[model samples]
Target: MSTFTLDELVRVLRESAGEEEGVDLEGDILDVPFDDLGYDSLALLNTVIGIQQAVGVTLPDDIVSQELTPRLLLDLVNGHIARPAAGKA
Candidate 1:
């Protein structure tokens, strides 16, 4: 099974869109809202795309809006990664 960690998310976020000024992604940001982290909708959307490319997962279109925090996003992605495809089992 594939696993997506907070560190990976930070890396993908930086790769997709450079970190905002004065924001420390290395700190405890799991619960912090994306807005508080200086990330807008567009930035998050790009990060989602990056995650998709990096993890080979097809996330839902509404994921960006649905998962506001990093922890939430991690949960959603990991859940998707752990689930088996339809008709396989």
Candidate 2:
């Protein structure tokens, strides 16, 4: 399983949105959704894809379908790590 951190996710998210300043995401960003952060689904999808590739987590293409919070993303990745689908690495 890959060791992807929430902090790294936040960094990638910020960078993906071309936001380098004034995006205070220091504390519990786990509960914050992408829309609340003023980001669209594309940004969230990009972030999810980046994290999936970085961590090798087998995430579905529509991972942003649900709430799409940091905690949800982490949980999904952890679930995939625990039990990957058959015939899938």
Which candidate leads in TM-score? 1
Q: Which ten residues in a row have the lowest lDDT in candidate 2?
A: 15-24
lDDT by residue (tens digit), candidate 1, 16-77? 98899899999999999888898888999899899889888778757777349999999988
Clashing pairs in 1: none
**What lDDT score goes with residue 80 in model 1?**
77
What lDDT is obtained when candidate 1 is compared to the true structure? Answer: 0.86
Report residue 32 deviation for candidate 1 (angstroms).
0.1
TM-score of each: 0.89, 0.76
Residue 29 displacement (Å), model 1: 0.4
Candidate 1 RMSD computed on C-alpha atoms after optimal superposition onto the true structure:
3.0
Q: Note each model's CA RMSD in angstroms.
A: 3.0, 2.9
For residues 1-89, write the lDDT of model 2, one tens digit per residue: 55567777777777676453555677667888767766678877787777776767657777686467788877777777778782163
